[model samples]
Target: MKITDMTSECIGKCLNYLSFDDLLRAAISNKKLNNAANLIYEQKYRSKRVEMHILSRLHSNYFMTENRFCFYSLRTSFQFLFCFGRQVNEIHISYIPRYVIPGENGVQNENNVELTHRAIDYANDYCAESLRTIKFTRIQDASRYMKRPFINLENLEFYDCNFTDLVEYNLLNALFPKVQKLVLKTINKNLDQPCTLKFIEGRFAHLKSLHIESNSYSKFHHADEYCILKGNLVTAFRLNPQLKELDLDLFVNCHVFQSNDVLLVINYLQNLDSLSLAIDDTFCSLLDSSVPPLMYFRNLKKFSLNMQLSTESRAIQFTSHQLDTFELHGVDRFTNYEYEFLEKHPTITKLILRGGHFERLNLSRIAAALPILEQLMIFDHFKLKIEEIVPHWSKFQSLKLLCFFHTKIVKDSDLKPLLINGWHGRFCNSPNKFQIILKR
Candidate 1:
């Protein structure tokens, strides 16, 4: 079929794979392509993309030779807003630089604030019913722009807020209480001031996934004063205990003085399907306990442990039907325990070890231990070897991806078992066997 005769729907689906600039270029020259690109952009309106869209307006230096009727290239944005604004799924407000009038040179502060507020007004008037996500990136003051919250907003994200004044959850909740997926990253707060919001039974009625973190690991913000993880989490936990996918590791310390606190938080959410947390001190108190508390996560199918310190436990062991995906990140000294634990969990389909104990991480043993293991990823420093289990190379019956990233291999010859007898990395003797990946 000729490209011109193709339906706009098909052309729009094709645009999904292309980058933004490419998509616009592909759409502008062709009539069908233009319609298709416009239709697709309505659905994929992520805030990051919105921010770029704003900048593209200001710094779009090259003179345009394409069709002026095109949605993005229209003479003025009002043409697109009047026609398609209501269909867009997200509203983006990223502290945009206001328009420079025909005669103006530099930015006018009063004009910019009015312009920013006008965009918010446009969102509140047109996209109120459809807008489900609103993202604020490095927004210092939202008072001028945040005139009203979209009642239907389901996701809200605040990124790089550590560089600006922190927005209290109470005020944010009042704005987006029904948000299901909320991400608060790198938020700088004053711990000395007392919180004014009274306890509410369930402030977040629709919350399902919550990611609250302190500053990103750039400077570590090293001082305790900058840490948000040390605060009282009792109110937030009690209010949103039903969250299914929880990642609080952002700043909560799970080390020397805060180990019990971490365990207590986990114990409260026994029904979580996935949990990701960070550890500061050690893994001994929890992993070395007579009864590892992590095992008690009966409903937890996926667990990611980000260890800031070394994993000092001797051996790890757990046998559960529900527990499958396990990821351990950090410098680990306990390979014997990982081996023991892997052998016990046949249900584990995805395993990621960011920190592996050298020499003891036997690929042959892992192939033998995990029967249904589909994806295996290793990162950082690691030494892997394949020993007696080489003879049973076909043991990797259901294996798929075995990846090694940034891992230093001590003995290269130990990998010979994978090549011998045309084994092809000692994979399953099937057409759909796993691939052994070696990455720097």
Candidate 2:
């Protein structure tokens, strides 16, 4: 069959898998393909308004908006949105700086406070009221501006934001009153400063998730500073009692990341369904073997704990009965207690171990404990006795993917247990249901 003669359903499916650039080229190839593309893309943004970034880049996954059509090159690919049927959305102001616009119409320049404001104005005057999310990147300080709220924005994210941008902007409950999720991230490796959380502008009582991942080498470790930061977090969590996930731990060595104190404070959030905490030896010191460290989170489902730098033999217990995923980093002899914990929760399907030296632990023991585990990832770890898993091969029929990243096996034959299993497949060398992937 000729490619152009295919039905729009098949053409739409084909376009769906194409890369953004390729999809554009295909959409412009012929009339039928363009119609199929319009039908497919329109369904995606039917209820939700089109995503228009006031700034430079929009992720490839985002649907093209009329604002994006301002760039001349894509004028052809996204021409479907400009068809005579839909009324064109107007650009907020006629006088935007030449540097802020992308492509030939504008010159690429540094993002500053003024440019950020222009982007805000674009959104404030945006004809579409369903614009639900906004991301501010490399913005220094937008605390001052037209001071209008994005009435419908539900998720607000700031990447490499100014140190006090959120604090100064204060997430004014009025500006983003309906925001359910707020994310703050800093890839600035050299941000060696201290900032407080206590002085944030407004108490957003309706938040469902708050993720802050700043790896700054914080200088606020004094006793008074610690007390204040801890109290501030507790109060924030209290207000956002519906918070489901709080992922403040990304960089293990970030001094600003309050480990021991955060571990103690987060216990008050009982409804948390997912949690990630990157702690060190100090947090381990607070763990009591008799009582699980995470006893308070009754509804917890997915939990990740990175022990970063701990050499001593410590035992930490988890009490979440609904846990579906567990990731542990910097494992030592203490992981024996983790195995004990998983033994009680056989429903866990994913287990990830990273940058750890397992002296007395066995891979098969983990499989033996959690028989239903489907995905197992081990990254940057010492050599493992994967051959030892042969005894528990029967228990792992439910397993699907086993990945070893930068972690070497003892020898070539060590993989025989996972591969070439006769019970799950026809041949010993070729298994059908499971896979063993090795990464360097």
Candidate 3:
């Protein structure tokens, strides 16, 4: 029905599916509909207090109030409590100028001291008592704001802010006091040109999940070097005892510590059930042959490692008897040592192998080792002697998804039964169909 014919019941149902903005637009065309929709939107989607600031107003009299609805500052802080309006549950502030690097186009970049204070005030006033998740940004010096620790925030994220310098220690120390999930991005590994493990022990003690990514690969490498010398990486694993998931990718050339050093750091992270480790040649070589004593991650389910495997040495040696889902990259040369390693534990059900020459691979040996293997992915061209083990393929009857890329033997005639029953994935030789053949 048209707007005139529609009743309040019809409008309420319609607005339920429309976003606040869309509903507002629809209401503007009809006063009765607008009045009814406004009430519902405010009751459901609208926050009791909404605050937005483009600049700090810390010096202004507006912030002096003991309790207020919304407080925002581009200079200082809007000091207000949430009691005035349910404790300002959501606060969003952006500092885009800090992103403009100092020397870029000769822009003289200086610290926005006033703005920094304003940000800390918002976090303290809005998030200290009742806020659920507060996202803070444009923090040139997160350290100063994070010092007092009045926050009970559950989720915290920092963009283009450095949190590792001694100057910022108080800031990190303050932020993670009660935060459950913490994320950092596009920030300096070295706050002031020197590498620092800014949050190893002081911050994130209560963190359950941690995710860090560098905007530039080179900068991340710079951070890795700092972590190694200061033992920051090791200390991080030890500090977050309650941490359950970790995703870290270092960009710079990492310093290769002894295997014991690596184990010393990882063993402390026994609580980690989902782990993703992405290292380059320098770091992977360190873990080549040495296997860290598996700390009991009884709940461990998914484990992935993306690092270069040195032909001279195995890139990583994982000996977890509990690991179920496994993905490895840069592991080819199927040496006897690598083969024996897998033979010892064949319980893994899913496997993904990337970037390796399998010319030396023994199909029979692999099938014997992992009799229960179900899903396999090989993403690289390798010389495979499939003819040798065609008859023994019965062992792989349990296989479900098999993928081959750029292999020498695409359609081996002897492998007919396995192809029809299992889902065969391969590159199509023509646009019409995938180039896969079965044995007669």
For every candidate in turn, the CA RMSD to the true structure comes to: 9.4, 9.4, 9.7
Tell me, by lDDT, which candidate is best: 2
Best by TM-score: 2
Q: Which stretches of model 1 miss by more than 4 angstroms?
A: 1-49, 52-83, 96-122, 141-144, 162-169, 187-202, 216-232, 252-257, 282-295, 310-321, 355-359, 364-369, 383-392, 405-440
lDDT of 2 by residue, 246-296 (tens): 886544553333435556555567788888777765555556456635544
Query: Which pairs clash in model 1?
Result: 255-281, 315-337, 316-337
Q: Each model's TM-score?
A: 0.63, 0.66, 0.60
Q: Which model, 2 or 3, shows the larger lDDT?
A: 2
For candidate 3, what is the lDDT? 0.55
lDDT of 3 by residue, 1-440 (tens): 57657787777777778864465456566667766666665566456433433332232212322222233344223322321222445555555443333234644344455655555665665456666566656555554554445466677776656544556344364554788787766565444433354554454766887776553435445545654534655666676667887767553354433345556666566777777666666655444455534334555566776655444545245556666667766555666756775676587777777666666556677678887877766665443444544566676756666655433434544344455544343334544223332221
State candidate 1's TM-score.
Answer: 0.63
Q: Give Cα distance to truth, residue 389, candidate 3, Å.
A: 9.2
Local distance difference test scores for all models = 0.55, 0.57, 0.55
Q: Which ten contiguous residues of candidate 2 have the minimum total lDDT?
A: 88-97
